[model samples]
Target: MAELLKAGAVFFVGFLALYLLIVLVVWLGQERMIFQGHVLPQHYAFSFKADFEEYSIPAADGAILNALLFRSDSSSRGVVLYLHGNRGNLSRWGHMHRPFTQRGYDVLLIDYRGYGKSTGKPTESGLYQDGEAALQWLLQYYEARKIIIYGRSLGSGVAAYLAARNPHQLLILETPYDALTNVIQHQALLPLPGCIFRHHFPTYRYLPAAEGPIYILAGSHDRLIPLYLSKRLQPLIGTPENFKVIQGAGHRNLAAFQAYHFELDRLLLP
Candidate 1:
């Protein structure tokens, strides 16, 4: 029995050490794991709009990010600064913004540093800087109060953080996680403490001080970002009307549903 106990203790210690090492590796390689972007071809075209005015905004750290400003058919209500998901570039994500443009709201979509034509390695803090830079560039043509920020998936954290810091009028988050740490833990068989995460896009942390009205649109059938996680945000915002969960909608295909736009219209028009 004494020998068996000693062997069991040794096995437990070894497993703990191996687990810590795995966590360390995940921490170091997280940036690459988080951001997936293709190399920008020299002839990369912006087919999102023919008259789409492209600009190169400089971050505080001197990284140059490429952004697209989609003008409305008529004079706009405001510009929607769209922070998109982790995959693809602004050009791909721009297809998702036609609802805003069709409503006479100009949409500004940005490629995070290292995505599409943008330069500089992407970090959590650097993403926040990129968002601010895009907003400031928009302010050159529109007032800060006129801008409404929208974020989807990975961009939700960036959008929430920006809305909290800036004077935007409205904030719309689609399938946003409570935090990146929460995302990783929820997907795991056994959840871990959030302290191990290095790339902390804590959207919940910023929601408390968000300056504008907050609207959350989440999918009831979202497999990637569970509905319960999105539901957790309701307590923080303290308003049932601010949160909406669409039936039979998944993470990537929520926009395809008519109910999605129905909810959006209620929020935008109301």
Candidate 2:
């Protein structure tokens, strides 16, 4: 009986140690996992077909944020301040702005810190500052009512943060989560304490105070950020009806679907 008890205690201790090690590793490396930015050379020239003017916006903390201002072929209606996902630089994401630019709205896409030519490392707070700097730069030429804030995936939190603090024409979040904590917990193998995460986006907290029309787009088959997680954010919007679902679309492929364009047309086009 004594031997059996000792063996059981040893096995429990070993399992506990392994679990703690996993937690420590995850906690230490969560930033890399969350912000998967692709760095670019300082002098890398962008070769997009669209008419774009690139600029290096200055962040409050001395970070240089690289951005592209894509001018519309037709007369400008407004500008979409597009905050992109956690992966890739503006070169990869610039092509995704056709939906807005082709429809006569100029698109401004900024690379988060450590992404593209943007200097400094990325942090949740740093991204918010980067977004504010972008908006301030835009305000020099365009009125607040002419700026539409759009967030995608990881950028959703940044968009929400910006919208909550600034006045804009509209706020759009694609494949967003209620909170970063909720997303981390949902994707974890085993249940994890919320304290383990350093960045808690808390879009739900920002969405309530955001000015202007708030619209959320969700892909029916988004495995990265599931439909239900996006649905959880519907109640935060003043008009929950603005919550749009693109059927047959997944996280990254929503732009390929006709339904995605249809929804954008309904919301954006004259």
Candidate 3:
């Protein structure tokens, strides 16, 4: 019986060691999992069919952030400062400007640090600073009332952060979460300490401080950021009319849904 007890103690120690190792690995690799930015060459030329002018905004940290401003063909209603997700550069996301530009709203989409032509590494605070720089640049041409802040997936946190501090015409979030920790915890293989996460983009914490109407759209079938996670944000800034759910839609395919376009038309059209 003493031998069996000793063996059990050894097993427990081994298991604990393995668990700690896994936690360490996850902690170290959190940035890669969170910010999957695609880097572009400095000399890379963007060729889009849309009427767009490129921009090079200087960040506070001496990083040069690259952006694309797609102008509306018709009379401009306002401008949309679109903060994209964690994947790919402006080349992959630039096509999305059509939805806004077609509706007479010029779209200004900027890449975060180390994404596309931008310089330096990306952090939660760094992303916020990049967003602030973009907002200031947009304000140079348009008033705060004519600016709409649109955030998608990973960008939702930054959008909420900016909206909380600055004045904007509207705040639109797609596939947002209450916080970045909520997303990691929901998808984690083993329960992780919040400290393991380097970036905690607490959209819930920022939403209450936001001025004006906030609209949150989520796909019912979004496995990446499940509807429940997005639903957690509704109570922060949602009315029955503000929080929208697109049925049978997944995380990446909301634009394919007519219901999504209907909502956009209602919100964007004059």
Candidate 4:
């Protein structure tokens, strides 16, 4: 009996130490988990186009952020401030603006501080500053009502943060998680205490104060973030009717489907 108790105590101590170690790892590397920016060298000249104008918006921390203003030839409905996901730079993401620009809505796609031709590192608070700076830069060229904020994946958090603070024509979020806290907890394989995270992009908290029509687009089969997370956020913005589920769509391939365009029409057109 004594031997069994000793073994049990040793096992308990080992498990406890391992659990604490995991918590420590989460604390040290949470930023990497949240942000996956593909950085570019400073002053990297973006390719010029006939209709596009590249920008180097200044941030509070002296970071030169990279962005592009994709112009629409037809009568402009508004400009979409396109905030992309956690991964990749504007070079790859620029292709996505066609869905908006082809429909006469210009696109303003920007990279987070470290991504694309932008300089400086990425932080949650700093991203909010970058987002605001982008919005202010856009407002300089167009009226406040002519700007529509669109965020997908990680960018949705930044978009929600911006829309909550600024006035815009509309706020469209695609495949957005409820909060960074929720995302960490949901993705945690074990029942770990992921609630004490540092990077809290509280989209649910921001949506309440946002001044625009909030259109939430979620995928029916998104494994990275479940569809119900988007459903949960709908009540915070408006009725469940505002939550539009694009069938057969996942997190990354949402733009590849025609249903994605259909929903954009619902928000962009009357």
Deviation in Å, model 1, residue 3 alpha carbon? 12
Local distance difference test, each candidate? 0.85, 0.92, 0.93, 0.85
Poorest 10 consecutive residues of model 2 by lDDT?
Answer: 185-194
* 10 residues in a row with least lDDT, candidate 3: 185-194
Tens digits of per-residue lDDT, candidate 1, 72-186, equal: 8987888899999999887678686688887778988999988999998888998999999998888898898889999999999999999888888789999999888777766
- In TM-score terms, candidate 3 sits at 0.94
lDDT of 2 by residue, 1-270 (tens): 999999999999998898788778779988988899999999899998877899999999999999999988889999999999999999899987799988989999999999999999999999999999999999999999999999999999999999999999999999999887777667766677667889988898999999889999999999888899899889989998999999999999988899888889988997
User: What TM-score, to 2 decimals, does candidate 4 have?
Assistant: 0.90
Residue range with the least summed lDDT across 10 consecutive positions in model 1? 186-195
How do all the candidates rank in terms of TM-score, highest first? Answer: 2, 3, 4, 1
Give each model a TM-score: 0.90, 0.94, 0.94, 0.90
The runs of at least 3 residues in candidate 2 whose Cα sits more than 4 Å from the true structure, single-residue gaps closed, are 1-15
